[model samples]
Target chain A: MTPSKQEILSVAAECFMEQGYHATSIDDVARRLGATKGRVYHHYASKIDLFFDVHREGMARLFAAVEPARETEGDGATVLAAMLYAHALAVLENHTFESVVAQGVQMHRFGATTPGQRSTLDELIASRDHFEALFKNQAAIAKKDGSLADVDISIAVKTMLGGVQWSLIWYRPNVDSSARTRANLAKQMVRTLIDGVRTRAALQQDKPERRPSRAK
Target chain B: MTPSKQEILSVAAECFMEQGYHATSIDDVARRLGATKGRVYHHYASKIDLFFDVHREGMARLFAAVEPARETEGDGATVLAAMLYAHALAVLENHTFESVVAQGVQMHRFGATTPGQRSTLDELIASRDHFEALFKNQAAIAKKDGSLADVDISIAVKTMLGGVQWSLIWYRPNVDSSARTRANLAKQMVRTLIDGVRTRAALQQDKPERRPSRAK
Candidate 1:
């Protein structure tokens, strides 16, 4: 049976994440799928095309997860927290695709792409900027609403996003598997990021710190 | 004039960071130095060797910055914050080397290195693990002292380290130049990570949140 494009992309994303864009080839993707290079070629004209598609699909998944949270009725901090939670879960669940997205971002940043691929790279970067803007806007609102601490919104948002996104490099799914584990991990990540920016009063009510020893 | 090995590593690190290991050649590094490949080859046997050296230097710089803070007389929270601040500065100041370090970590993680280079890769990995252990031990102490929140020490440390390290990917020195900017950026990052884990009372006194209006 001929594998579908989505199947091909899934296998290709895994190969790319494992081997990297420069090292991964259509044959590698095909072999991983237990198929021939022709099978992959039928879906993707070239390796670069397949790579960009995986990147685009990864961004789409992130949007699907967080867009709802962005639209949900809540204060800025609440909305930002919801969006961050959704994003962390999406990253954990779609690890391979997100890794590709990260690779694509680096490729563009370092001018590793060919001239022909520049347009697609630009589109991907724009999507990333848009995604970042969502968090930035909400963070600004949260600051104005007095829910967040007096921090630089741009730096705070970037650092928070960076913490969540770096999961691609560090999170090993094989070691930490299970739906509960994933959810708990996402919750922990969200709490750290959101609480990092929450107002002192709000943070006090949210998760009170451990009691200090009198001796100390 | 014969360029020193340190000079070659710095140039090679810039080449590797900008163009990646596969695309960057010894000739490219030498050309960027306005010399011949012989200069680079004289100091290093192969491109992989140079790459590993850059990775080692990067790790060494990080240790130089953070190890002092580790030994300072202070509580865990104070120690961790100092270490993180020093780390952020190291990453920003040595952006090229740190970028190479990040690339090396990813390369090793994804099995991109050849069998010949595996031992060196293992050594680099060990160094990275040692660095993380410093943060983990201090976080444990902070938690015990009731200075930190009741979060998983491992997760919190990894996430905090991730946020600071991801600066290598997002920080642009050309755009945000000056010593003051770098120092301020590091301070902000340390505050977010440390405050995120600090007890509510501790955070409140350190940097009070903006007051909210009762009209809302």
Candidate 2:
């Protein structure tokens, strides 16, 4: 049977994540998919096309997962929690694609992309910025509502998002593959991040100076 | 003027971090250093040697920055805070070297290294594991002391460390280059991470049920 475009892209993402862009070739993707080179070529004109498609799909999946939470009607902290949960789940579930997204981001940052790919790189970067803005907007609201700690919003948001995305580096699907486990882990991660940024007032009603030396 | 081995390693690290291991050549390093290739060749036989040396130096710098804090006389929470602060500072101050370390880790995970480099990679991985164990040991002690939240220690350590290391991706020394700014940023980051994992009882004297839905 002819492999679908989605299948090709998925395999390509896995290969790229495993071997990286320069090391991976069309033959590798085809071999992994158990399809002919012609099969992959039918879907992607070149390796770069396959890579960028995977990158785009990764971002699309992220937006799909988190946008609903951003649109949810709730307090800033609540919305932010939902978004964080969704993002963590996506990272765990779609590890390969997200890994590609991360590689693409790093490549762009370090000028690893070819000049011809500059436009696509820019568009992907813009999408990433837009995704970050969603969290930043909610964080601003949370800070105003006194739900978040009085930390720099940019630093807090970047650190929290970095923590969530860093799962790509440490998480192994083969280790804990159960859906319930993933959901629980996601919830725990979101809670830890939210609680970390939460205002001291929200965490306790008294004894603000418990850790006097470290207290802000 | 002859460039010291230390100077070569630093410049080589910057080159490796910016252009990646494969793209960077000895000539590039030489040109960047305003010296001939012979100078670099005199200190290091090949680019691989330099890359691995930079990786070693990065790990050594981290150990130097963090080990003192781990050995300091304090509770786990305080010790962890100091360690985290030291780590963040090391990452910011030695941005190029740390970036190389991160790249080396990724490369090692992906099996990008040559067969000959396997032993070196193993040694570096051991160093990384040892570093993580320090944080985990402190976290366990903190948990026993009722300072840390009741959560999975492995997940917590990985997620927290991931967040701290993720600074490599987002932090730009050119943007906020001042030592004072870096120190302040590091403190804030450490606080957010420490606060996030601290037990509610530790964070507050009352009102534990305020966010009941998220409460463990």
Note the chain A TM-score of all models in turn: 0.89, 0.89
TM-score of 1: 0.88
Model 2 over residues A106-163: C-alpha lDDT tens digits? Answer: 7788775677888888899899999999988888887776556567778777878887
Q: For residue B147, give model 2's deviation from the true position in Å.
A: 1.4
DockQ of 2: 0.37
Off by over 4 Å in 2: A71-74, A112-116, A197-216, B71-74, B197-216
Model 1 CA lDDT for position A199: 36
Taken in order, the candidates have interface RMSDs of 4.8, 4.8
Write down the C-alpha DockQ for each prediction.
Answer: 0.29, 0.37
Score chain B of each candidate by TM-score.
0.89, 0.89
- Superposed by TM-score, candidate 1 places the C-alpha of residue A104 at a distance from the truth, in angstroms, of 1.1
